[model samples]
Target: MTLNQMFDFTPVYIYIVAAVQLFIGFSLSFAIGQILPLRIREFMYYLFSFLFLFIPFLYEIATANVQSGMRSFLFYLALLITIFLFTKESFLKKLSLFFILIFFDGILEIVICSLYWKGICEKLFGLHYTPYINVPNQKVSTILIFFLPVALAEIAFNFLFPLLWKRYIRFIHLTTFVEMILLPVLCTNGFLIFLPELFGMTGWILLFFILFVLSLLFLHAVTQIPVI
Candidate 1:
């Protein structure tokens, strides 16, 4: 499939919804961080992280729906809370990095999966493969598309996050910076969920423009963070 067709299949707003859920989880963690004593927060962080890791399993046990999208989303939300509690960085830096990491993961997943599908289609069926035609090993391709990008993104984050933290990120207060990231994600998510038909190409274009501006602002903000 062409890139445009691939883009058409995966709406931009799905990522926005995921981002909103992630931010909500982060906000909840932040609120908990405020209310709890340090010792309690530390203890709960470990405890909750361990339990959150089993969210998908718990979901499967409760609903018997192994392929439910809600299960995956809940797992990711749990992961965000786990990271928020575990990271030693200032809250603002943690929020910034979490946003970037989520964005990076979504981009990686789409690009890798789309390319893999295209390559396999072309290899087995020549250049004229259509989505309607059943391809061999379809189940294997589906599994790879679902799991490989996530695994790769996790590995990349584990390897690179510490380096980025040490070399680049400085502890800073920037509530506006975090708000800028959160607002667009939340708004897009709401629009797509409630008023999807009205949110078309124009809305998508506007969202991309907003994201580009935010990215530039983030880069500038990074430069202004004072070194401790």
Candidate 2:
């Protein structure tokens, strides 16, 4: 009828959207782990491990409902159990392993957020009203307080660990160097400042492309994985 009526501003809408996100994360991880090869999984785990570092802080912003929070936490915990049970990653690559663990936790959260954007989330769960809760997407204070630590930790974990994973250091160095160079520019351009926008997805697409290529090169230089 009118713009106001068309908007669907009901609390029921929030509940439904949040519920769908929780379902998609764990389900997709399972599907992916099942389909890909072992080596591919190793590469993906490394790639996704770094990608995941930003997720928890993002999710903490997205779903402010009480029911959403509790169930989502449990779902992530379960996703970890499933992946660990199926993984072939060695225990020794300590830095890589550390990233893998944290990334595993974060991916579940990211997948949930992605679903929220896709509009499928509302269909699975519906209409519940609750007290007012603020979920401003670009939560600058909260992001700085929680995610600043994560960003610093990424420096230590992603950039510094190469000293020990000496073989992969060159590639990790290259990877982190690129990230170091691009991160400030990205922040300035308003992804971090604005939040929830896919601003310049190309940069990230290229960045990850470079990281994966470098990883392949590094793996090739050190070990003789077939490149066919």
Candidate 3:
């Protein structure tokens, strides 16, 4: 049997999705660590976020249906509430930051996937390797097109986020920051779930363009953050 037949790589997306959530979790911990005056050990922050994000997806993977829906949102919300309670920030600030973190995680992925998806898909197609069971509506080469670049973009963005944050992320009011980030999360997530067909090819190009504009505006809003 060929390597593709030897190893099943289809469920790999579960791991990839988990990995992205972990990255988001870590980024949230780091961001919260920076903003809050709590004296949390850096390791604990990562550990908490890891458990919070990992467990649900792990369960989904085991069950053979890894979906992002109302259930997923509720799981995340519960975890966010738990994490926020661990912080020293005021109640309202904690709530705002919770949404901000969620928004950041969601939008960051959208931006990366939007920008590099085609390049990643093309590169994979060039390899001409096919897994045994193919994904519906997609070729084997393209099955991971979204995940691979999102993974790369996640790493790059995570690195640049901290650096640029220090330089470019001036503290606007907490409420404003939350509001700005929230728009993209709602629109992107809602559109994706309800009208995913609108996100195909040309739609993705337009969606990405719109998201790019929003990201710029969000970054500009970041510059307005008041020193908290």
Q: Tell me the whole-model lDDT of each prediction, alpha carbons only.
A: 0.48, 0.38, 0.57
> Candidate 3, 228: how far from true, in Å?
18
Model 1, position 82, has a per-residue lDDT of 70
Q: For candidate 3, which ten residues in a row score worst on lDDT?
A: 131-140
TM-score of each: 0.44, 0.27, 0.60
Q: How many clashes (backbone N, Cα, C below 3 Å) per candidate?
A: 0, 1, 5
Model 2 lDDT tens row, 127-171: 121222344233233323322333333333333333433455334
Model 2 residue runs over 4 Å out of place are 1-11, 27-72, 91-228
Specify the highest-lDDT model's number. Answer: 3
| RMSD of candidates 1 onward, in order | 10.8, 16.3, 8.3
Superior by TM-score: candidate 1 or candidate 3 = 3
Q: Is candidate 1 or candidate 2 better by TM-score?
A: 1
Clashing pairs in 2: 12-127
Which whole-number lDDT from 0 to 100 does residue 125 have in model 3? 52
Clashing pairs in 3: 171-225, 171-226, 172-224, 172-225, 172-226
**Candidate 3 residues 1-228, lDDT tens each?**
543443264354454555565564555556666665664676776566666766666654564344544335535654565467556867877767666655666777766655554454446555443331244224333545545556666656654554555566536466667747755665655433422343457766765676677677677776766544
